[model samples]
Target: MKLDDIKPDIVHDVTGTYCPVPIAETAKQIKEMEIGQILELIADDPGVVEDIPAWCSSTGQEFLGMYEEDGEYHLFVKKVKELT
Candidate 1:
């Protein structure tokens, strides 16, 4: 299924947060969720440029994709099985 089609079981809006903290929290949420779950992260922190991708790489979660809508950057990830 497409990234958007996968309903994120967990939604995290860390717009005001900064650095790796927000992305780390997103990863943490994913870790605590059930296998094959989805996590939708909406982060405004520019650090998300590196944080999100880094988190995905380290956790092995599927980094489906990210896009900008209106004035927000939306990141979509699927837990798919487990964090490899």
Candidate 2:
């Protein structure tokens, strides 16, 4: 499915936050989500452009894609497994 067409099961907005905050929040939120669920993380930190995908890779989740608008980034991640 297209990234634009993917409806997220949940959304976490960290617009003013930076670096680890965005990634940390994503980790915490994903832990509560079920497998196959999608997370839309709204962030203004440019670090997420690399951090999100790297985090997803290390965590084994699916890094769907990302898009930027109005100086903000909207990243999509799909839960593919459980986290302890």
Candidate 3:
């Protein structure tokens, strides 16, 4: 499915926040989500462009991809592994 076509189970808005905050919040929110569920992280931090995908890869999650909208980024991440 297209990245835009996928609806997120959770939408975490970290706009106006800086690096680490976006990634930090994403990490926390994903823990409360179920497997296969998608998390849509809305962040304005440029760091998220690299951080989100890297974080997903390292954490064994699916980095679905991202898109920019209204000067903000919409990062799509899917939960693949359960928190231990």
Best by TM-score: 2
Candidate 3: worst 10 consecutive residues by lDDT?
Answer: 1-10
TM-score of 3: 0.94
TM-score of every candidate: 0.80, 0.96, 0.94
In model 3, where do residues sit more than 4 Å from their true spots? none
Instruction: For each candidate in the order shown, give its overall lDDT on alpha carbons.
Output: 0.76, 0.95, 0.92
In candidate 1, the residue pairs with backbone N, CA or C atoms under 3 Å apart (3 or more residues apart, or in different chains) clash, namely none
Best by lDDT: 2
Q: Which residue pairs collide in model 3, if any?
A: none
Candidate 2: tens digits of C-alpha lDDT, residues 1-84 = 788699999999999998789999999999999999999999999999999999999989999999999999999999999876
lDDT string for model 3 (1-84, tens) is 798599999998999999779988999998999999999999998899999999998999999999998889999999999865
What is the clash count for each candidate, in the order shown? 0, 0, 0
lDDT (Cα, tens digit) per residue for candidate 1, span 1-84: 666576777888888777767877886888788877777888787777677777787778778778777656678777765643
